[model samples]
Target: MHCYFHLVHTHERILDETGIEVSDLEAAHYQALKAIQELKQEGEVDDVDWHGWQLEVVDEAGRVLLSIPLDAAQH
Candidate 1:
């Protein structure tokens, strides 16, 4: 399955044009977490704020599969 990870905050969002291929939803979830971790690390180094951001995993039809809070990467 292909999943697009969109960075969103309320009505604002940065859409993912090219998505990644995964075996299943579980793999997609893992990828989202990994992405969040990388984003958080970059944010720290670049002094960017991502307090209310979320990573939305969606399918080809634009149906959300998972919604992960950016701050969850802290754990």
Candidate 2:
């Protein structure tokens, strides 16, 4: 299945879009977290105040199904 993972941040109105192919919801969830981890590792999530950020998992129709809450990527 194809899903869109939206990284929504506290101080930003624009969403960071990541498209992925997954088998099911479980896989989608994993992919979302993995993306977040990669972004953090690359220092991509540092410049924002992301204390209340979220990994929003949306279906093909753009319906949000699950949201993985996030903390600040760096201290």
Candidate 3:
């Protein structure tokens, strides 16, 4: 299955144009966590601000599978 990971806030959304293929929802969840970790690392390197944002994983049909706060990636 292919899943899209989008970064969304109250007023804006950064869409993932190229979705990833995963075996199942569980794998997709793992990917989301991994993405968060990568984002954290990149933020550390570049001093990016990711406050008030969320990582939203969705299916091709646009059904949200998981939602994680960007702040949760801290520490």
Candidate 4:
């Protein structure tokens, strides 16, 4: 069985509004969500962001397939 991992960065708005600091693991999940959205839109692979957070795509074997840096340009 092949397991896919999606990593995502937490949105600044969400962090500020909630007044919660996301842990490293949670942040990855957030980035994954963003990556999935990008994949859906572009029908391919892409990375976004580069500040304090970023997104990473991985496989079941725990290998990073892609890394996307979250940047302001995306917004």
Candidate 5:
């Protein structure tokens, strides 16, 4: 399955052009976890909530399947 990972930040919104590939819906959760980690690294901060950021995982049809909030990722 192909999923779109869009970054919904407090100041900006980023749309992912190339989606990610996963075996199934369950695998998409793992990918979302990894993507959040990368985002944290890019921000040079372990806690992304300071900037009020979140990752929205959407299906091919544009339906949001899940939202990974930076604050939640800290836990």
Candidate 6:
């Protein structure tokens, strides 16, 4: 089985305070993960986050296939 890792951080206090729908978050997370996997297979530099979420896709061998830093535009 393949697994994907995500690190999410929000500087906006409102976001932290707001209640997030678990099902929606889960669906979006997996969808983004799947897109990253496809990008990895396509030989594209997978470093993109649609929202405020960082993603890291690693293979079973513990090799990082993709690493995208979210909130990059903020810098």
| Model 2 lDDT tens row, 1-67 | 8888886766654454657789999998888878888878877777655778788888888898778
| Range of the 10 consecutive residues with the lowest summed lDDT in candidate 4 | 13-22
- Report the C-alpha lDDT of model 6 over 11-67, residue by residue, as the tens digit: 431112221232343454565556556655665434444366555544445454555
lDDT of each: 0.85, 0.76, 0.87, 0.47, 0.80, 0.46
Q: lDDT, candidate 4, residue 60?
A: 47
Runs off by more than 4 Å, candidate 4: 1-50, 72-75
Extract clashing residue pairs from model 1: none
Q: Which ten residues in a row have the lowest lDDT in candidate 2?
A: 9-18
Q: State every prediction's TM-score relative to the real structure.
A: 0.85, 0.75, 0.87, 0.35, 0.76, 0.32
Give the candidate order by descending TM-score: 3, 1, 5, 2, 4, 6
lDDT: the better of candidates 1 and 2: 1
Q: Score candidate 1 by TM-score against the native.
A: 0.85
- Residue 53, model 5: lDDT of 73
For candidate 3, the TM-score is 0.87
Candidate 4: tens digits of C-alpha lDDT, residues 23-74:
4545655656655566547744334334555455554455665555555325
Q: Per-residue alpha-carbon lDDT of model 3 for 1-75, expressed as tens digits?
A: 999999999999999999999999899999999998886676651475668888999999999999988876775
Deviating ranges (above 4 Å) for candidate 2: 9-13, 16-18, 72-75
Worst 10 residues of 1 by lDDT: 42-51
Q: In model 5, state the lDDT of residue 60.
A: 94
Q: Which parts of model 3 are misplaced by more than 4 Å?
A: 44-46
User: Could you tell me the C-alpha RMSD of candidate 1 in Å?
Assistant: 1.9
Residues 1-75, model 1: lDDT tens digits: 999999999868999999999999999999998887786677661465666778999999999999987665565
